[model samples]
Target: MTFSVPSPDAIPRPDPSGADAEFWSALRDGELRFERCAACGTLRHPPRPVCAHCGSRATEWVTSAGSGEVWSFTVIHAPTLPAFIDQVPYGAVVVRLDEGVFVVSNLLDCPVDELTVGDRVELVPTRVDDELTLPLFRRA
Candidate 1:
């Protein structure tokens, strides 16, 4: 199949409710945030209800430095979704941010063959659509 970028309408929107509400909102405003425990100094991703490090319910959001290195990745050939059948050879990368948090994102500019573990990447807050913003990355 020929490759084509998915239309904005085809992309799913984040749920406006729940622990991820502020996380998604910050990205739309051109910022990246991670959950941190207010009761104890610990960071967590996926926006948990309580701190994994400590059983604290008090949490805060920490802004990222917008720079990181590729921790791991894989080039997907299997069709993940109907809207991405043609985009099979895309790279799915896990980036280790400067804050020591791992974030899953796709590369914005580099090809799969050129991408490698430990490659420095910089954040590019892209507005996928009027209501969706993504923290895409690129080779630095």
Candidate 2:
């Protein structure tokens, strides 16, 4: 499945840096990655500088298979943000990656009424422009 997104100019671009730098870089290069604590091998999302399970500052970037299930989701029938006004009725989802960490991103391609818990999805690295990219999902 596939869907159209707002123009790159209309959508806000990400400012990738710090712990987020690698993740965004990987996405731009067409890969999905997560932060894993080097000391304990614990995986985490929203890439952090320190491990939550262990107080380790050392971490590694692990590429994902980009396979997951829809853990939860919601449809924005009426967007409150002006930038997304024309994109009303989009899906916001929490995808539980096969590696165990959950990622919050938009669920694309599938219709709101058809979206359901446990729905299988896969990564679709979306490039917004020369400087940015997004890790969007689509039903597999």
Best prediction by TM-score: 2
What's model 2's lDDT at 139?
89
What value does the lDDT take at residue 86 in candidate 2?
72
Q: C-alpha displacement of 31 in model 2, angstroms?
A: 0.7
Cα lDDT, all candidates: 0.83, 0.84
- Quantify how close model 2 is to the true structure by its C-alpha RMSD in Å: 1.8
Please state every model's RMSD to the true fold in angstroms. 2.3, 1.8
Return the lDDT, model 1, position 134.
80
Candidate 2 lDDT, tens digit per residue, 39-103?
99999988887999999999999999999999998877773666677766677889999999898
User: Judged by lDDT, which candidate is best?
Assistant: 2
- Model 2 residue 126 distance off true place after TM-score fit, in angstroms: 1.1
Q: After superposition, how far is residue 42 of candidate 2 from its true place, in Å?
A: 0.3
